[model samples]
Target: MRPAPVVLVSGTETVLADRAIRLLRDTLRAEDPTLEVSDLEAGSYAPGELLTLASPSLFAEPRMIRVDGVEKTSDAFLEEALAYLRSPADDTYLVLRHAGGVRGKKLLDAIRGGLGGGVEIVCAELKRDADKLDFVSAEFAAARRRITGGAQRALVAAFSDDLAELAAACQQLLADTDAEITEATVEKYYGGRVETTAFAVADTAIAGRHGEALGLLRHALASGADPVPMVAAFASKVRTMAKVAGARGGGNQIAAQLGLAPWQVDRARRDLQGWTDEGIGRVIEALADTDAQIKGAGRDPVYALERLVGIVASRGEDQHSPQRTG
Candidate 1:
């Protein structure tokens, strides 16, 4: 399809917004190799700049003018943009990049109300694991590459904290290999991220693997992983297990009720086995203390972490048990 005369790329997801802009640029360039591309910073825009770029050249080639930071646009840019929307130029693509603010309300209102007859591309944040998984799948799908379901989930779990990193991981896998992507592939590429390592420690600890959890925790800390997020990982997994502990329903139904992804609900349900409500509550209490200690309430953060691991591994019973004798 031909590019819209005016395009509004709005929202706070920089990765998605940049992808949208690049796709538009690539499409226009393919349609007309002689496409004249120009970039204007709306935040520092000068008067008449948009018109200067949008004006017809002697060669009269197609033009693509991208206006960025529209959410912080100056008054002059705002006025001229509103006017441009009143009459968008022919054979020209005007893309307005807005990262969300109230700075250019009048102009945004005009464009949204059909003053420019433009198409909107909203890049909302990918907050849910399901959404992030969809993003990973689409990235691979766009390249006509294949990725297994387990690989998709593993990638999401590893890079769940950063969309950019997740996207980069996908791109790296796509660029580096030709084989069908699998869970082992994802682990090979991103098994060392702090989020991944932290979650590993959390999983080991929560499953009663006391020695393994301590080993993983120590390795993670030695690898420069912050203690706060390590505790947070435990808190996150245990909290999820707590949320779905007694809930009875299909994964989708329960996930909706708990505001979690279906995969997360399923994983939590699996983690909840052999765990009682009382055990979960005791773990939560230990997590609170460990969180504070890791944040500087105690003398030895490492010891606090070790203690927390032991507590979780014992299903929150280790803390109350008599100390082992030498």
Candidate 2:
């Protein structure tokens, strides 16, 4: 789709905002290879700068003037930009990038009020796992590339802390291979990261492989993995298992009810195998205690982590299996 005369790329998600800007530039360039691109810093914008860049060139080539740091625009910029909105120049696309602040509320309000006839491309942060998964899916879908649900979840779990890294990983996969992406593919590329290592430990422990779980856990710690998120990895999986325990319905329906993705429901169902509600609850308690210990309750975080691994590896049988009270 062609960009509007005025485009507002607004949000705190830098990666998404950058992508939006790049896509606009590419689309404009495709339409007219003579596209004249220019960058402006709103924070240091001088008087008459916007008009100068937006004015018709001698050859009358199309222009895309990208103004960044609108969230911290100078007073001069604020006045000029709002005035320019009243009568935007022809044959020019004014792209505004605001990273979110009250600094330019007047300009943003004007744009949103239809002053410039601009369309906003919001780049809101993907704060939830479901949102991030959708981002990965969209990235592949845009390129007609196929990625397995498990692979998507793996990529999300591996880079949940950073959306930029996750997007980069998806791009690498897309560029490096034409074959459908799978979990093994993601693991091959990003398995060495501490986040993946933490999940690996959690997966091994949850699968009841006590010895292997310990090995992975120790290896992760030695690799300088933080105990907090490692414990968090266990907490995340066990909690999903707990949510899926005794829940009935298809993956999609159950996932909708639990605010999880369908693949998460399926994975949680598989993880719940050979596990009882009592076992899940027990492991959750272990996770809490371990979390506390690692966060300054206990002197030896390693011992606490080891204890947690054993508890999870045994499906909570490491402790006295608490009987359910009617």
Best by TM-score: 1
lDDT of each: 0.84, 0.84
Clashing pairs in 1: none
Off by over 4 Å in 2: 195-219, 222-326
lDDT digits (tens) for residues 189-270 of candidate 2: 8766776678778888888888888888888888788898898888888888888886765444577799986446656765
Q: After superposition, how far is residue 148 of candidate 1 from its true place, in Å?
A: 1.2
Report the C-alpha lDDT of model 1 over 232-259, residue by residue, as the tens digit. Answer: 8899999899889867654546767989
TM-score for each predicted model, relative to the true structure: 0.63, 0.62
- What is the alpha-carbon lDDT of model 2 when measured against the actual structure? 0.84
